[model samples]
Target: MNQPPLPEVLDLAGEHFHTDQYATYRDILEQRPVTRVRFYDGSLVWLVNRYEDVRAALSSPRLSNDPTQQTDIDLSAATGIPDDLSEYFRRNMFRSDEPDHGRLRKLVTREFTVRRINAMRPRIERITEDLLDKFAATGGGDLVGAFARPLPLTVMCELLGVPEEDRTDFQTWSQHVVESDPAFAERNAASYRSLFECVRSLVRRRRDEPGEDLLSALVEQRDAGDRLSEAELISTVFLLLVAGIETSVNVIGTGAFLLLTHPGQLARLRADDALMGSAVEEVLRYMAPIEMTSRHSLESVEIGGVSIDAQSTVLINLAAANRDPARFEDPQSFRVDRNDGSHLTFGHGIHYCLGAALARAEAEIAFGLLLKRFPGLELAVPTEELTWRHVFMRGPVALPVGWR
Candidate 1:
């Protein structure tokens, strides 16, 4: 009912994750911590910038994660999913709330037990080695495209039973799905259809001819009990492919950037292999790729000392929260040995990232291999020249690197 008094309109468009942007968020946090801003799609959303407010909103049951409840955002255009399939996409655990979210998370969490994830170490390392073999051959290459993109993509595809044929050339579509650039706000509906249709076909095929893959296991779960639905089956596959690939890809890409830029930390990590876990956690904290997520107010709730009415759209700034001076000491600096991995990088609450462990494992292994293989690795292009994308699934578009 009121307008943003000139300064409240923040851009969530195709803007690079520039340093000044963080300062802007810091300013917002210090002043109106819980305020409104317009997203790139011309959709107005309540932006929560302060650490406590963001953390509370992320886990608060009073705020709903269901995209269908959102009146401000045009879900159809933003997500690039058709009407029939949009419901399935929206019902995915990431977007679902309550018992449904719990059930979906429970089923997937069972599949990611320590034993199962540990078993994949060999395969993950093997994939990283194979990718490194190629990267080293190029004397260096675009790390994002060459190594970061394919390694996790291969691992996720193989683990989820997504055929190799369906994995290539799909990143651009997923990137658009996560971001809304004013210049390219027009989403490619065809590409989105092909993506979902491909996954849907794979789901059906897995049912008819099950395999020893995670998707088949999920299919078995669906068949054994009414716990999983057809829509959910598609949605799970959708999440594993999109979030699994995208999340891990950006973490690996940017994690490498961190090591490259902060050589002292890089040297410290290289000196000790045990720091791999801590280093990964530090990277997640320092620069959470999924900078922000939304929650629709289920009831009138007080956040950041301000009472927000029910049904109001709220944006939780994960990146800002991760770097909050109150939560983290010298939050701006990158520390490889920052053992206190309590940052809300993977998020908090029931909606905490399902694939967080897997993402961490991949990054640790990927970074370790890079340290061992490319001792003197440095950015092929200057840092300022790097391209960043997506207000949501964000990361360097192309990470060119060279090494001795």
Candidate 2:
């Protein structure tokens, strides 16, 4: 097949891209479905914009999640993990392919099973109420800081048996680790070291004194057999802590922001409790927590009629795919009851998020309790003044909300 000429490389690290992503995505999806984009660090990746192409790229065997498979590109540098800590940070399932991905995922899959997640409902509710009680007492504050951020942090810490006293430090380190700004490179590296040492210490504690927590179970798995190595064990815990907490925080915060911004949708949800599930799904589709994910092409591949060279980085824009008009009707519109199809927010294929079920459960409980408690809930500040975090994970830094 004759390949189409590549489009001009666009800059994706600019403030415009961060401030108005959906608009930028819409333009790309329509005019340049398959193109290359340059990041702030001058690294280039082929950007897949349309829904079908993004979905196909995500599941294609030719695209490998493991960075080591790429020969031409230095993915290790792209990851921004300091050299000394790279082994500890990059050895998890999220960054692996094939047998290794399956093995690492299997070790913790049961803990996030539907049955296990469902079992967490009572405790999740209690945590939600406790957070809400504090918010209610103050009348209102930055919802993201006071409620959304802490809810998942608290849940994840409790699940992993992280000491209550250490949670503040953990949260601080996590924020630094996940920040994508080049200015924070030094801080990010320092945070990576801090996080690695912290998880390593937790692993030792779990090994010496096993508890009923998930981390302890993983520690036991390592001790009982050679199933998991020390690096793998600690890395898996780190992945769980960062991935499990940050994504949920984005979902809950973004979900509430969507609800407050779309009054009609909020009104419909308030009137019909059955719309809760669909509402959450809509939020995921409309404003995906993680906007884009990256993979490396192991072999030359064609997507949307554009041929990509082997070892080339390809970025799947989840937020753009979710809003592709080819897959969704009125894709830009936010509707609580609309059930077009499943969105790629939790993604598809082998690398689908393992904590998806848990995130959904937390969001449902959080929103249900929130609306019930504050029927008049609304944004406390002008929408234009709100600031979003410029990172892979998308959410407002602080959502000041009020209810009277």
Candidate 3:
């Protein structure tokens, strides 16, 4: 049998990757479904672009999420995370495979169930209202800073029993960890250290006091048996903090931007309140918060006719897959009532996002109440003037909007 041709190599970094990512993905999906792309720090990975390829790559057993599985790469060093501290940061379910992944996921699966998340709706609404009340008082501000960032951060912090006063520190530390900017690279280790230390303190407190929060529950499980370890516990909290907060923040911020920019969809949604759920799904698909996720190929695998060697890194472009024309009708257009829910924004198979339900509920409440309260909401500045965060996740750094 003949081997497939090597994938074309391309550089994807700086302004183009951050600002016009969709266009770049489109070109790759149309031409090179699988290509090797060099990232900011000069690390190379096989970039899978098409919908089918991305979906297959995400669920393929051949692709492993474990950093330790990579034979040729020091993932921690490549990503600027210290080798010694990498285990604490990467021990969570998202970075695991097989029995360990299942074990870690099972521990927190119940907490994020649709039922549990729905029960928190009332509290989520109240939080939204409190933030909106402040926004209304000011009449306009950076929606991200004033509302989008805080609402989810507050929810995650409260869920983890993080003290109110400690949230600022948590936000700063998480931002440093998630930001993809080269400037933020040097701070990654320090941020991870801080986050681990903070989580350790919280874990100790939860073990002693045992509050009604998820951290307390996790601590109970850890103490009850060997079901959970100290490192895993800390990592779980870290995952929930960074993953839970950032995804929802982007959804709220980018969702708002999408609605405001696409007035027709916004108007359609406003006219028919029933479209809120569909609108949320569309926002998720159209502007995926987590753009791409990397996995280590456990063995040699063929994707989109390109062969990936054993222990090679593969980056599945979720944003590209979500908007692939082959899967979505008018993939470029944002429609409130598209009602198509097959997008891989929450991923698929074993590693599907654990916080999907909570993120959706928070977004629905945030947008529903936001539109209801401020019917006149519009961009505070020209759309081109708005800046996006160049991070592991994609969202506006600040969404300035005014309801007046």
Candidate 4:
């Protein structure tokens, strides 16, 4: 059987925010919606970059989110965690399929309803204001380090009742897991182990003394019935901690960068605080934090005019899809008032992000508070000098800003 020539491997995992890369995605969208592209580690997956195709593929039940079916890569072998940690990681809903996914997600999602998130606005504002108070002291600093990064990490930890003392450690471990370099793959194991231990200890504590917190609710549900397993409990907590922090952190950082660069739109947003809702959606569409996600075909299925064999890998480039010309009028430009919130940044179908409401609330509060406080905020360094980390969720490494 002769195979077709593979498409040029796009380095979507590495350096982001490049013109040439987006140009390639646009080219792919127009020509080849579904094609094979090599990941940074030389692994090839069926890359789906078109807007319509990406949405269809994401919602298709024939394609499963379970990576266990992808024989091409042993995910555990790559991460190299201990058996207990590995098992816990496997139980996480991010990789779950069907019945188990519904069961696990149901147990934890009550804490993440839009109303619940809306209720947290006062607390979220307090945190945002406190962060700004410190930022105001120096008048300028890396917004990522000072404001973007810490804001979500703190909010999530506080919500889960994580000790004020251990929030920093939690942030460090979570970042290492997602942003790990291929060179430091071995260190990745230790990071997971540390996080696992921390989460396990927290679970145990919640059992002993239940409180007005998400973890306590989870612990109570675990005790009540067969609805949640022990490992699932730990994994759910882990997922909430990581997902809640990672997505919102990137949104705040990336959203702020887009606004800072597109001052006209920023001014428009500032002038009318009523536009905050649309503004956040526009930011998400402009620069998705989690650029790509992969799924394994459950059976031989057709996607984007290509026949994918059973157990084949499918990688959907959400960032590229969000920017597809077919979807938006001027996909390249950043507009704060863009009304559509159809971006696949959080994903689609059953696997859509559980903490989306939380992410949205955080962004709305973070942006609203920051703009109100630092009306003079602007980049401290030239745009070219700004460094972006090639993490699973891409955002500025250090978004230095100055306020007049």
What lDDT does the true structure give each of the candidates?
Answer: 0.80, 0.87, 0.87, 0.82
Model 4 per-residue lDDT tens digits across residues 267-325: 89988999999999988888888888889998999887899898787888898899998
Per-residue lDDT of 96 in model 4? 83
Q: Which residue pairs in model 1 clash with each other?
A: none
Backbone clash pairs for candidate 2 read: none
Residue 37, model 4: Cα distance from true site in angstroms? 1.3
**How good is model 3 by TM-score?**
0.96
RMSD of each: 3.3, 3.0, 3.4, 3.4
Q: lDDT value for candidate 1?
A: 0.80
Tell me which residue pairs clash in candidate 3: 180-391
TM-score of each prediction: 0.93, 0.96, 0.96, 0.94
Candidate 2 per-residue lDDT, tens place, 1-404, comes to: 33334347777777547778787788788789988888656777788979888888889989999877765545434445788777788789998998999999999999899999999999999999999999899988999999998999999999999988889999999987787666677788788888988998888888888899999999988889878888888889999999999999999999999999999999999999999998989989998999888899988999999989988888899999999999999999999999644899988899999999999999999999999999999999999999887647799888999986
Cα lDDT for residue 272, model 4? 98
lDDT for each residue of candidate 1 in 1-404, tens digit (9 for 90 to 100): 33224374665652323444666666665666777777766777788877777777788888998887768777666655677667666667998898889888888886677777788989999999999998788887899999998988899889888777677755666655555444543465655676777877887899899999889988888888978888888788778788888888889998999989998998898888999999999988887878888899988899887888888888888888887888888888999998878888788888888787788889988998888988888888889898876566668989988876
Error of 4 at 52 (Å): 1.1
Candidate closer to the true structure by TM-score (higher is better), 1 or 3: 3
Q: Is candidate 1 or candidate 4 better by lDDT?
A: 4
lDDT by residue (tens digit), candidate 3, 1-404: 33334336666665447668777777777777888888666777788889998888889998999878876655555566777777788899999999899999999998999999999999999999999999899879899999999999999998889998789999988877886655556787788788888899999988889999999999999999878778888889999999999999999999999999999999999999999999999999998999888899988999998888888888888998988889998999999999998999999999999999999999999999999999999998998898886535888989888876
